[model samples]
Target: MRLTVNGSILLTELPLLERPAAVRAAGFDAIELWWPFASSTPDQADVDALVQALADAGVQLTGLNFNAGDMPGGDRGLVSWPERESDFLANLDVVTQIGERTGCRAFNALYGNRQPDADPVAQDSLGARNLAAAAAAVARIDGIVLVEPVSGMDAYPLKTAADTVAVIDRVASEHGATNLGLLLDVYHLAVNGDDVDAAIAAYRYRVAHVQIADAPGRDQPGTGDLPIERWLGDLASGGYAGWVGLEYKPAMPASQTDPFAWVPRERRTAH
Candidate 1:
């Protein structure tokens, strides 16, 4: 079980270009990132600079997200949003190109919040179509498309591991592409009252990526009541040998104290 820091979470206070080095300085060689630029389709210079940052820092980008609109402003994702479907499609090439450059094989695609005025059937159909398209696009690079069940957002349909897997299955079946997988986030599962053990037992084979954050306050591992180690151990025991992303909110600034106290320094590296 290798560990990878989620740059979006760990380096939230720094500029996008500065995050790769910060992650490396924190003793992690592999990191995951959300779409770093505000625009899904950013200029080539911005892309080159981000690639260069990771190269200069000696950190590998293990995973990346397709642009989920305004992460801090509560926009869950654009792929499934009817109004933003085109934007999501347009971003496929951009994200895939970045993935190719960064050696990121896993790409998370969030299901958008349900629209109140739109017909539910239409929304579901559109989401399926877009997800199928996404699956095909990333398959060109032998990348896996991840579908995650997010918690705390009432409007989002996927709130359980089962829900996420169902979508993964749908995309795989619809597109005949086996590159679709589930991104099991322990925080979201625990927060939504789902049985983490049962989820791993049922879906471990389909999991391509795993994210961790303690439940309740969504804080670092030891800061909350969840059995973070046991869960991680369970994931390993269940045959998940992939990178586990640290997607938690650090309790304090990194300069004051190490945010990864729960994980020993030596265990943090992918090597």
Candidate 2:
């Protein structure tokens, strides 16, 4: 399994370049970077430079994460609130460009807020409309546009595997795009009450990328009450082949612990 350090959730102290450097130093071959790309340095040149840094470090670009509109880390997706559609598209373009430049073929479009009073049918329609529009745009490019089932946010409060699959199917059908895929986040799955086994079996094909962190607190893998090894083995058995993103919070300092020791070091990909 390839592990992405989840540059934001784990490596907050380093620049985007150094995050991958740390990953390489820790013996990982591929790494994940987050949005707020400007945060690394408010210069596009710097973003490109970070791409080079990853290359120099021998760390492969696994994926690029887009920050949906929200209060820092809120679940405000593009489709639910039509007003921010412009901002949503704008951000997508920025990240899409970053992906192209950095050799990234996978991108995550997290599900956003759902209007409390909006009829379920109408909400689905609106979200589908927005996602299809965005997916079409992404399909024109070489990258894959993936949707994450987000919880605790108004937009994508999918607590069940069925609900999550419905969103994925609707987005794909509505967009008429086959590039749409799923980001199976184990943390969200546990909190949303999804059956890990069933979810693995059902979404094994569509699950383009996977992230693992403990639920309840979104901490490291062993820190939570999940059967991590079992589920991971099951997914692998289901013929799933993709990067296994290590998107968890570090219980200690980043310098202190090798967050990915749980991952077999020899199997880690180098590019």
Candidate 3:
């Protein structure tokens, strides 16, 4: 039942550079993030500053997203987009560097939305290629590549655990990629009408990382109708001994005190 704060989503009131320290101060020794840089290949100094910030905050970088490209603009990911294949490939170097520097092994590569103009079969083919490359790169550090079923965007194709697992299987079969795995995001799966219990039972061994938020609002645990604690217990029963990323919008804004009051303070840190 180890927990880690999602620095990218949790401490939105602080500047990006300052969120790591805030996560640490809030009592989490480990943090995960979206791609922290605006550019796929940011200046080397910016990369160093991020590494230094984590080191100074005494928070371990447990997970990170590869450049997903304009998340605010509705671009789910670059991996499945034919036009952005080069961008996705170029970003892998930076991902590998960050993994090497921070000892972060799990990397989530979002499967992009389906394109109206492109062939779905072709997009799937290209996604497998791109994912294979990412898998090979991260394997250098003994890391695994994560593909998640995302929700909230209709065009985003991967909306169920089955959808993501299909892609994972394709990448493994076609490319012999053993390092690719599933990122079980409970919020997305629940919101998309997938059976969470079935997914946990079926793909528990394939799960590389897990994230949680209450669905219907994507907010903190108690604010919505999800039995998050029970699901966590189920995951433990299913033999999942990995970091559970707290990735929801705080019901109370980060400007206020104690957004994490829902979690017992002693349970906030990884065991």
Candidate 4:
């Protein structure tokens, strides 16, 4: 399996435009991002700078997320939020254009937290409608839209591989878009007490991308109880030949100990 880094996680202290170069300097040729723009509709110059940054750094953008509202403030995503639907729609074209420029084929659309007044049925219906639109938008570029199950966020309905796959199926059936897939983040599954091995065995075919972070502390692999090597072996045996994204928090700053010690230097580059 090929290895890629998540710039949002790896280089947290750097400027948005400079993170790609830091990822490249760390020996990874492929990286992913979580809507680096401050506003959903950033100026063209910002977009040009981002595209140029990736090109100048010589890194491939493996995956990206459509704007999730205030990720640091605990918001999951805007697509499914009834109040922010316009914001999600506004950012759709920007995301696809970024994908077009960066060769990123996998896009993650997070399910927002449940609202107090909205019923479950209404939330799901709206989520389906928004996800269908996102699926169609990215399908024009041969991109696959990902629906992920996040852990620890109870208000977010999708918290298991099965839950995420059900949404994926719903969108595919309702919109006739087969390009939708699941983004299996091992950290979330492990935190939620799901069997990672079983998940890979059952959902390998539907998985478009895989992200990893050790549980308990959500830090690098060795800082927690997860058997990283064994899980990776299972994924390999299950025929998941896609990028394994390093989405862990560094124990220290990038200037300190190497955050990627678990991944060998030779395996850091995309094969």
The per-prediction CA RMSD against the true structure, in angstroms, equals: 1.2, 2.9, 0.9, 1.2
lDDT of 3 by residue, 1-271 (tens): 7888898888887888898898889888999999988888999999999999999999999999999989999999999999999999999999999999999999999989888899999999999999999999999999999999998899999988889999999998999998988999999999999999899889888888999999778988888888888888888998999999999986666566577888888998885
Candidate 4 residue-wise lDDT, 1-271, digit = tens: 8888898878878888898898888889999988787777889899999999999999999999999998888889987789888999888899899999989989999989988888888888889888988888888789988899998788888888999999889877887878888898999988888788888888888888888898788898888998877888887887879998899988788788878777788998875
Q: Stretches of candidate 4 above 4 Å error?
A: none
Local accuracy by lDDT, each model: 0.87, 0.71, 0.91, 0.87
Supply the TM-score for candidate 3.
Answer: 0.98
Superposition error at 199 for model 2 (Å):
1.2
lDDT of 1 by residue, 217-253 (tens): 8888878898989988888888889999999987677
1-271: candidate 2 lDDT, tens digit per residue: 5566677676776766677787777777777855655331237776678777888888777777665654466644555655655666666666767776667888776656766666667766766776666666555567787777765554566666667668878776666656777888888888777787788887787788888888767877778799887888888888876788888877788679766777677766544
The stretch of ten residues in a row with the least summed lDDT in candidate 4 is 254-263
Q: Pairs clashing in candidate 1? A: none
Q: How many clashing pairs does model 3 include? A: 0
Q: Which portions of model 1 show Cα errors greater than 4 Å?
A: none
The TM-scores of all predictions, comma-separated, are: 0.97, 0.86, 0.98, 0.96
Q: List ranges where model 2 is wrong by over 4 Å.
A: 38-43, 71-73, 115-123
Q: Candidate 3, which segments miss by more than 4 Å at Cα?
A: none
